[model samples]
Structures are given as C-alpha cells and as structure tokens.
Target: MITRETAGELLARIPVSVPDQPEGESPTAVKASPFTGAERRVMGILTVPKWQQGMDQGVLPRAYQDILDVVRDAPGPVRAKQIAPRIGLPAETSKIEGVRSKLKRLVERGWLDEGTPGLFTPSHAWTANSAKSP
Candidate 1:
C-alpha cells in the first residue's frame, strides 16, 4: 500500500500545482484535473495514493483474506456482493464497511477485475494462493 507521503512525492514531480481553493474567480485558478495527457499517464501508475491512510486505521479480519482467496480461484468473473458474504459481511450496512472499502482499492490496484457494476473477479496478477478452491 502506498503511503500519503509517497503519493505527495510523486504528485510533486508533475508540472502542475495544487491550488488552495476548489473554485475561485481568477481565470488561472487551478482545476481538479489540471494535468495534461502526460500527467495522467504518471498518475495511473500510482495505485494506493493518499487513500491508503484510511486503510492503515481500518479493521481487516482474517475473513477478508478468505474472501479474496475464494474469488481468486473462481472459474470466471465474480460479483463484489458474492465475495462480501464470504468475508462475513452480507450487506452494505455491515459493521465492517472497511471490507467493502478495501475491495474497491483492490480493484483499483488491478488485483481484481470489475465489470458493469457490482461484478468483480480476481485479476490474473493474483498469485495461486488468491485463487479459488476446487
């Protein structure tokens, strides 16, 4: 997982500057996405970014790992909801929303694959341990 400090370091190298305000009267005020094509390419490589800060404080139980293990060996794409229960979270309002949150990050890191919406599957990059059981 990338740390906040790491994200800041990579972002600093880009030519663009971060602004203090989201919207301002000045024409030169920075926009959310001030980067050009080149910057986007660099940003893509940064997987965790500052969002990792949240995970550091979040609670992740062994069940979560089991869920990933289950999906890893699925014959085909799996749904996010299906994996949720395997981790002991069967609904969105479960106590451990962190499970859901980390799943999103995993998807972003290319450790898992996503489809139309709620569907997901393990990415090829996952090791055999992450695969499903027979």
Candidate 2:
C-alpha cells in the first residue's frame, strides 16, 4: 500500500496536454440552429396539440397518426388491446398498457375522447371538423 504522499508524487509525474486554439476561434462561438431551413415544427410525442377546427393531422408524428387512423376506421370506441394488433404491436399486457397511456395522453390533448373507461375514440370536435373539410 502506497502512502498518500507517495501517491501524490506519482500523480504529479503524469503529463497533461491542453489543446491550443487558433487566434480567431472562440470557445463559446454560437452554433447554427439544428432546425435551420426546416419548414415543419418539431414537437415531442407528449406535446400533441389540442384538437381544433382546420387542424391538419400532418402535425402529428407517424405513430400518433396511425393510432388515430385505426380509431377512425373502427365502428366505435376501441380498447388499447384491440388497437395494439392493428398498429402492428403484439397484444401483450405491457404493450396494451403503453397504448393505453398514449390514448390517455391523446384524450388529455383533445385529440381523442374517453367516453367510458378503457375505450378510446376520436374527439367529437375532431370528427366534426374533419367531416366538414373536403
């Protein structure tokens, strides 16, 4: 076992190299925006906008659009388990729960309606608005 004093001496022998920057470049230079020149807005999965008249479904991500499509094509409100298979997900309990959480989020965002427990359907406002559009 080496003493603390000997350890310090050993560490002091290690050479540390610091990179030298050219005269013009500053360390904190502003970087270009990652979204530069992009036309569409970027949003996280949970940041789905509330349903409104004339809102385009293109604003949503593909996974969300798929969910909405499945629900819209259904005869009535659908359960998460029923949704999982149609969306290409295996009908496992965990997958069902994941779909349920997304459905709940859609309801909270006004994109869907939860008229009764465990059943999800498109919100009335969304369906009505979509029907009026060409």
Best by lDDT: 2
Every candidate's lDDT:
0.53, 0.78
Q: Candidate 2: which stretches are off by over 4 Å?
A: 1-46
Q: lDDT tens digits, residues 1-134, model 1? A: 47767987988986765557555556475554422221213435532422121122112234545656767657776665566666666567553355556667767755566665656676554543333423
- Which 10 successive residues of model 1 have the least lDDT summed? 49-58
Please give the TM-score that candidate 2 achieves against the real structure. Answer: 0.65
Leading candidate by TM-score: 2
For candidate 2, give the lDDT: 0.78
**Distance from true location, Cα of 128 in model 2, Å:** 0.6
